[model samples]
Target: MSEEDPDLASRRIAHESLTRDDPTGWFENLYSAAADGAAVVPWDRGTANPLLTEWFEASEPNGTSKTAVVIGAGTGWDAELVADRGYQTTAFDISPTAVETAQRNHPDSQAQYVVADLFNQPAEWQHAFDLVVEIYTVQALPIALQATAIQKVGELVAPGGTLVVIASARAEGQPDAEVEGPPWPLTKATIRSFASAPDLRLIELDESPSPSNPTATRWRAEFLRD
Candidate 1:
């Protein structure tokens, strides 16, 4: 038999969480297990996501004196990069263990890492950031919760600020029932829906081959709030 998939533990936990109607409750369970060395965080790449890095290179955003927020910030890689660009960064994760791990992983990092649920975000965070970075966070949730999650993400962007979303792409025609996932990949239509809010406008949406899996596609979309 083939070796067991490394992410199976996370998937199993997610399944149980979803069955309980607590879609996001698996995050803390998985992160806590990973902290005890009983499981692994399959998505913790230890470096900034390549899609995010590509955006930085192509846009050359000057974040100096500006504010940025990383949604579902895992172990701090993306947050560190944002901070490196001179943005006053706040990176938050629903899992307290993940937040603590991020702090431990980057001891001298400048980003303010916190434990915050996207659905119950602090009032001060609404429309508070000059730049909002959401990488794979939406897709990680159950498909039914994606729309609300996307809205919360968009609400973080200040007027005139930008929101960048990087996610594994699913063809628009693909059936959701066929996709087995803790990550139900985002379809083109769902990606475009990020701009449905009155305050948000879709600026650009690019689909490219995933760096790690060339056969798979990834979507990098940017939105601006009016």
Candidate 2:
């Protein structure tokens, strides 16, 4: 498949997997096909997200020896950033292929890459990390599952720990039903929900146009567990 054009076959297979009531199966199939550059991963930015990096720099939390978890770790770029900052990072994906791909991509990485479902995580992982980074993962799921994903994301933050959420932004009255997506941009209200209905408070919430595409925007939010 050409990098310029995403392989529709892979996407179709993934969508069918979801249609079959297998949420994680689509990710597995997508990653398996993406191996060896055979298919394009639309969200694989190929580098640690700049928004996350900047947040780390601004906060300068003493991450030394602290634990961090990167949700939907994909190819591990975000996890690598956390590890490099001195945190004991666990980068997990529901897709075993994605975990394996990340390990292969960065043989020297200090981050521990694992295959695990976000909805059914390890017992010890609940409220286990000093930091939890959720970047574009929740929005990737079907709208029906976003609430569950949001709840799980909050569950990972330890007492007084931090949560960073970065995702595409959806306008207040955009009539989302008309849009087609595996990546449904998040609305401000939905983003705020992460700060509420849970024991967390919003620290900062910013929405701005993506530099790459001015017409498209993103929500960069940070929250603190109470």
Candidate 3:
């Protein structure tokens, strides 16, 4: 089907429906469908998030061989960007299709792409990373599952490491109207849900204009594991 086809838009909306709740089965099924090469995810922009790239360039994490993990690493744009910054990066997605595509796209990069569910990750990954980048991954799950996702993010960062989350921001006091989304927008409070973790401290939380899509506001928060 053509990218602009009306049927494609309908299918995109259908894919988004799987995120309405923490429906692991539904998500697995959706990914399975794509595993055989079925649909193109609407959110795959084919480029690194400019804001994240800017942050990494400016911060220059001060050490060689730092390890970074990208959660829900759809299309691997963010992962590639981080890896390019000299961090040993691992990018994971629950969808095998997405992981495969990322590997194919970044053949020369040292980024490791894997298929892993964030909700139920292996124990070996706990506290294994010096940097964690979460972009539009938490809100992709149901609101009730948001905290669990946040906790897992915290678990991935080693002490004194950084956790960076980039998410679409909703206006204050916005109600949860019936909206279909894989790009589930979040409020400011929702973004801070992980900031107050006992083992982590909020270092910086900044919202800025989205360069590629200015219609949506974006938040980039950084936390340091204590």
Candidate 4:
């Protein structure tokens, strides 16, 4: 949220859009603005997240080649990681412009870049992917919509597969009202809530302070479906 904080007017518009019932269009708008050179895309690190890199690097590539989907795939760096590991990766963002940007970023990418809303994912995707990589999309949403977002994340997980999540974390007792943000970080309670679905169970969860902000922590969670 630090660098993503654009000019005051732009931030206001984005927050207003999220507070509405849709609670999601602001991402597309923000990415469009960034594309038009109005603001910067703070999360577009142009490289894979270290947590993801470490997770993959430390493990043996043992899973059979199966369908994988990257939610909020953005510019496709993380999707590339999954693809490199031999997963049939399908990376998606809510914004058509963002998907186009991702495709342009990785011209030879094996990952299929598409614009798909998490809340309205295609019916064919239910229980379809072997691995679901969702990073930061929920915290980027207002808390009001995060519950639905959580459910959508679980819905994308196929039986006997896994879901990988990385998101900004909040400490105990930090009220959402205290933080006015388009990218409102989640508390540990919120992070664990994604495991509430009976179909999924948390296998591992890690918390650490953000490298950029010592006060702000982040969570990397892995869930498995039984």
The top-ranked prediction according to TM-score is 1
Compare candidates 1 and 4 on TM-score and give the better one: 1
Q: In candidate 1, how many Å is residue 78 off?
A: 0.3
In order of lDDT, best first, we have: 1, 2, 4, 3
What's the C-alpha lDDT at position 113 in model 2? 97
For candidate 2, the 10 contiguous residues with the lowest summed lDDT are: 2-11
lDDT at residue 119 of model 3 (Cα atoms): 79
lDDT string for model 2 (93-164, tens) is: 998889998999999999999999999999899888989999988987877788999999999999988999
* Residue-wise C-alpha lDDT for candidate 3, range 1-226, written one tens digit per residue: 2345433543454465554643444444444554445544555677888778878787877536789899988778889888877888889998776787778888887899998989788798898899999987887665656778888888898888899998888886877665345445788887887776767888788888877678877999998888
- Best-to-worst TM-score order: 1, 2, 4, 3
What tens-digit string does per-residue lDDT give for candidate 4 at 1-226? Answer: 2344564535565777856855777778777877877777767777998888877877555545788999999888999999988899999999888898999889999999998999999999998899999898998887888999999999989998888899887767978799777678788788888899877999899998776678877899999998
Question: Which regions of candidate 2 deviate over 4 angstroms?
Answer: 7-13
Clashes of 4: 0
Off by over 4 Å in 3: 3-38, 178-180
Q: After superposition, how far is residue 70 of candidate 3 from its true place, in Å?
A: 0.7
How many clashes (backbone N, Cα, C below 3 Å) per candidate?
A: 0, 0, 0, 0
Q: Output the number of the lDDT-best candidate.
A: 1
Residue by residue across 59-91, what tens digits does model 1's lDDT show? 999999999999999899999999999999999
Better of 1 and 2 by TM-score: 1
